[model samples]
Target: MKVDPDFLDTLRLGGEFNARQCINCGTCTALCPLGMEIMPRKLFRYALLGNKEAVLKSTEPIYSCLLCKMCEANCPGGVHIAENVRALRSYLNAEVLEV
Candidate 1:
């Protein structure tokens, strides 16, 4: 997908921050209780690729997040998944207000 440059920048800020350190071991996904339904790893991939449509369209799953921080706790890279999710939620909320 052709993601907008501005949106891509946001993704980089959130996704690239610790992406190089990620091992893609699936620990985060495994540790995430929500992974029973939603996949944080997939969300991370979409964020890394700057797929804004996918990310934003998946906002419902994002909102379903318990923000338990379990994923962050288990992340070997210390990627702060909860914070990224919160940031994305904030961005989406602001966008909705502007619409």
Candidate 2:
């Protein structure tokens, strides 16, 4: 997938979540009871690298997130996981749905 290069910077403008803090430790995914299967870690990496298309295509996992903070509580990297999910939803609504 082609990287937009500016996607991450643009997402940061929302100031709701900080994906950069994530260390890709997989702690969040392991703790997820909802069986997220794909999420904040992989998605964050895509976001960090500005892979807009990859991130966008992950709508199922993104929207499937319960945002229960289950992952956030155990996150060793201190990533605001719920906030990141919310940010992704917001981005999709604004940029994809044009709401």
Candidate 3:
């Protein structure tokens, strides 16, 4: 997938999203009761690496985030995983989904 790494920074700079601080600890994915196949960690990496195709293809898991903040609470990096997931969903809404 084509990656535009700067897009991640744009997300943070353009919005209040804060996924850059993620430490890839997988706490979010672990606490996700849905047992999503790809989420939290992968999505964050895709976003950070600017993998637009992968990121867009991951719409389901992105939208699947329950906003429970379980991962955020356990995060040692203090990454707002839930908020970042919401931001990704919002970006998808405005750019890809356009809804």
Best by TM-score: 2
TM-scores, each model vs. reference: 0.77, 0.90, 0.85
Candidate 2 — which pairs collide? none
lDDT of 2 at 23: 81
Model 2 agreement with the true structure over 1-99: per-residue lDDT tens digits: 798989977786665858778888898888887666577798889988888988889989988898899889988888888988888888888889888
Residue 92's lDDT in candidate 2:
88
**Model 2: C-alpha RMSD to truth?**
1.3
What's the true lDDT of residue 55 in model 3? 85
- Of candidates 3 and 2, the better by TM-score: 2
Candidate ranking under lDDT, highest first, comes to 2, 3, 1
The stretch of ten residues in a row with the least summed lDDT in candidate 2 is 8-17
Descending-TM-score candidate ranking: 2, 3, 1
- Can you write out model 3's per-residue Cα lDDT over 1-99, one digit (the tens) per residue? 687867876666536676667777777678778888576888788787888788888888888778887777888889877778878877888888779
Q: Would you give me the overall lDDT of model 3? A: 0.78
The parts of candidate 3 lying over 4 Å away from their true place are none
Model 1 TM-score relative to the real fold: 0.77
> Which stretches in model 1 have alpha-carbon errors above 4 Å?
11-20, 36-38, 97-99
